[model samples]
Target: MTGGPSRGARGGRAWREGHAAEWIAALWLMLKGYRILGFRLKSRAGEIDILARRGRVLAVVEVKRRKTMQAALAALTPHQTARLVAAAQQVVRGRKALQALEIRLDLVALAPGRFPRHRRGVGA
Candidate 1:
């Protein structure tokens, strides 16, 4: 008997899609002059979707994908924001290169066929 895609397969597809959004977001940031420092940075605190730098500013970016930009912008919960902030701290501590830069929380919302909306200093 042929079976349909398993739960894990569906989850894996979602994961790949998420990562693809992140890659697109990263490119978008680069086009805006921010140097991509890291992607999917994980620590005991949490995971940071993207980390970038421009001059003395260190941006901790969260990438979200949804059917609409509004939904993507609303995706980050307060608890998750706290976790991202904490994780950014850990990320900076480990990387001496990021030590001197001023840290800021940023958001990148992605939807199909639209430019990524980058909001800086979001929930910082």
Candidate 2:
């Protein structure tokens, strides 16, 4: 078999972690009755891992895969936070249905084999 970690192991690890975060977030959103509009939403600044809606509220979510809350908190640098906010604003502007919707930012932080912790209304 040609199975090995040498085929870009770092990339593989990142990809797997990303997929895990998405799945975890998606399941959580579904359980909460939020309709997921998109995942990995990108713009000139950065990516919003998940964009969802519940009632009249629009949620822009950023996903972080880390070993702890401290690590996840550190992962969101100021520059990264600015970029995420910019991208999310762009997303809001681009959707007519979201034009007048209440916007909120969310962070879904996860450690491998652990449940995700959600932080809502994160601001720039």
Using Cα atoms with residue i matched to residue i, what is each candidate's TM-score against the true structure? 0.93, 0.85
lDDT tens digits, residue span 1-124, model 1? 3588988899999999999999999999999999998889899999898889999999999999999989999998899889988998898899897888899999999988788999998885
Task: Report the Cα lDDT for residue 30, model 1.
Answer: 97
Window of ten residues with lowest summed lDDT in model 2: 69-78
Clashing pairs in 2: none
Pairs of residues clashing in candidate 1: none
